[model samples]
Target: MTTKEIAQKYVELNRTGQHMQALEDLFAKDAVSIEPKGTPTEHAEGLDALKKKNEEFATMVEEMHGMEVSDPIVADNFFSCTMKMDVTLKGMPRNHMEEVCLYHVKDGKITSEQFFYTPPSMN
Candidate 1:
């Protein structure tokens, strides 16, 4: 798959609440994920660690929907995209969040992903 395709699929999986299955197919075995602001750690490396982080996020949010992708730029094996995430927090009102995600892909799988987003408070 192309980098854009992989990025789109990632959003699709998340919107559909198929987090684990998406990780299995889209993420590399040795993938690294960086979510700078929240959770168990800032960085998670390897599939096992990444899976754990994903599960943690899934547990935190009550519902996720209305994903929109834009500004997709791909070069070589790297891609960057801007995504809007509509979600309901566990104890908060619905939110429309915007994030910029940079992806490093190889052999059609995402090897690394870095996300930049304003905190929930800012949203």
Candidate 2:
């Protein structure tokens, strides 16, 4: 898939809580994911690790909503996008947050992702 398409699909996967499936299909076997400090998951390496992280996130959040794509920038093997996410934690108030995700693509699959987000208090 094209970088833009891959980025968009990632958002779609998150929105639908199909992250594990998306990870398996869209990411390279050795893909790595980095989460900014204070997020539920910190950093993950390899597809299995990512899947476990996604499952934990799904369990912790009562509801996941409000995913919007913005500011897509794509290059030869890299892409960045800003995403808005609304999540309702199991016991905490809902969070409306924005994050920028940078993706490294190789051989039509995402090989790495780095995330930067505003602090949770600002969300």
Candidate 3:
């Protein structure tokens, strides 16, 4: 798939609550997920690690009020979109989290994804 195709499919999957499916279908075997420095999951390399990271995060959510994934803005082998989630995490107050999700695609598959967001402590 082209970068635009992959980006669009990714946004669609996230919007439809099929995040795991998106990862399985679009990511390269050695894809990497990069969270902000100092976070518990600062880096998850390889598809399996990425999947585990997502599962661990899901376990931390007490309630998901809503989620929104914007249409992607694609630019030659890269894409970006805004993601927002309203949720209450385990032992934490409900919060609105927003981030810029950037992805790098190579050879028609997503190779890396990095998210930019303010830490809850900084919010």
TM-score, cand. 2: 0.81
lDDT of each: 0.82, 0.82, 0.94
Measured by lDDT, the strongest candidate is: 3
- Kindly indicate the candidate among 1 and 3 with the higher TM-score: 3
lDDT of 2 by residue, 9-116 (tens): 876776676768779889998999999888767789999998898788778778876667675688888988887878887777898978888999988899999989
Stretches > 4 Å off in candidate 3: none
Clashes by residue pair, model 2: none
Candidate 3 lDDT: 0.94
Q: Which segments of model 1 are wrong by more than 4 Å?
A: 1-17, 38-40
RMSD of 1: 3.0
lDDT of 2 at 95: 89
Clash count list over all predictions: 0, 0, 0
Better of 2 and 3 by lDDT: 3
Question: Please, what are the lDDT tens digits per residue for candidate 3 over residues 1-46?
Answer: 9999999999999999998999999999999999998777999999
Q: Per-residue lDDT for 25-86 in model 1, tens only?
A: 99999999887675345799999998888778778788876777675687878888787889
- Relative to the unseen true structure, what is the C-alpha lDDT of residue 58 in candidate 2, on a scale of 0 to 100? 74
- Any idea what lDDT model 1 has? 0.82
